[model samples]
Target: MTRYYRVLSSIIVFTMMGIGSFVLSKSFAEDEQNRKGQPIKSREQQESKASNNDLAKFMRGKLDASSQILDGLCTEDFRKIISGASKLQELSAAESWRVSTDVMYRQHSAELRGAVKDLLNAASKKNLDGAALAWTRTTLSCIECHKWVRATLISKG
Candidate 1:
């Protein structure tokens, strides 16, 4: 039963990750298409474009770190798991991660930090089961936070 549960959990996590990745890729493609259709930019537009580019780069780094964690989980590589978790913690502390001053946004950030802590603890103990569970939690936190961010942006607009 324990083994069955673990396998099921892993499948669910992977499915969620796949869906998230697909959505993100589609959104990026749409953004690129829109940019291509735009006319020449003014000074302010150019600055905004630069800022958006930086944010996109930062987000890609976060996704890479998350992928590392997934890889580690699959291979039972504790070192990779720890390294990835640490990278996530560091990224979460960056100025760019704090995209909003809203209370719910801060709560979401805190949830991610808590999930990362759990992941690190599991990795330190070399507990693959625990680490896998923590990874799922971490991924869910990220998905929820991103959903909230997108909703907030749409509402603001």
Candidate 2:
């Protein structure tokens, strides 16, 4: 009976060890697979991407508003000019409109804002000539900024 009990105990111990080894090996393989898989982005990176998308949407709306200024000028509607210029001024100061740490970007933004302000002032005074000049300045600033931004992005990539 003693011999039989010893054999049974040894069998049980070996079985338990084998089971433990299998479990540990499986866990290690899963860990390795995870390490080899696509790296997960940090929370801040994900949030930043979402924020940028929101900023893009806001900027598109701002562009539409800027174009309205031209339409207003074409129609010679002072009220539309004031409205469009006011919208551009407001967008210029918006958080979503600010997406860069570059000094040049900020300078261009300021230039555009200033041009819009001039447009607003001219329209208020019912000065068509001044409004036309301001609108021309605003359009040029937009083109310059867009070109610079495109070049910067292309260079980086």
Candidate 3:
């Protein structure tokens, strides 16, 4: 009975040691892979990175147009306002804008275009207050889209 007990204890100890080694080795391999800077990326991650690069110019144009719109509003320059809003509208319809067929993306795009249209109408009617309101709506739409883009594209999670 004493011999049998010793054999069973040795078997248990060896089995546990083997399991521990396996666990440790797997952890080390993952750490080594990370150190090598070759971490695997999911399909979504790859797509997000691709879209970010493709849309960089469109985003810059949006930023410039927004700035021009703000300057135009402050100076009461109808031409500047129209030009900025028109540029925004044109950018929205550009081929690059079709990066995604998402409904949320489409909604935001339409909202931006509509805001620009409102600004155009205000400018044509010489309605300063309407133009101001339309500008606010346009700004909000930009903010919302930016927030969504960051959450979906830039975030690792």
* Per-prediction tally of clashes: 0, 0, 0
Superior by lDDT: candidate 2 or candidate 3: 2
In candidate 2, what are the lDDT values of residues 1-157, reduced to their tens digit? 9999999999999999999999999999989989897467899888877887887888787788877888889989999989989988988888766667699989999999899889999999999999999999998998998898888854784
Q: Please give the distance, in angstroms, between residue 97's alpha carbon in candidate 1 and its true position after superposition.
A: 1.1
lDDT of 1 by residue, 1-157 (tens): 9999999999999999999999999999989988889777899989988988998898888899999999999999999999999999999999998778899999999999999999999999999999999999999998998899889965895
Question: Model 1 off-target regions past 4 Å?
Answer: 1-35
Better of 1 and 2 by lDDT: 1
Q: Is candidate 1 or candidate 2 better by TM-score?
A: 1
Clashing pairs in 2: none
**By summed lDDT, which 10 consecutive residues of candidate 2 come out lowest?**
148-157
Candidate 1 residue 66 Cα shift, in angstroms, is 0.6
Candidate 3 C-alpha lDDT tens digits along 1-157: 9999999999999999999999999999999988998557999888987877777867899889989988989999988888898898888889888756778878888888899899989977878889999999999998998788778755745
> Model 2, residue 127: displacement in angstroms?
0.8
- Model 2 Cα displacement at 54 (Å)? 1.4
Q: Residue 109 deviation, candidate 3, in Å?
A: 1.0
Instruction: List lDDT for all candidates, in order.
Output: 0.92, 0.88, 0.87
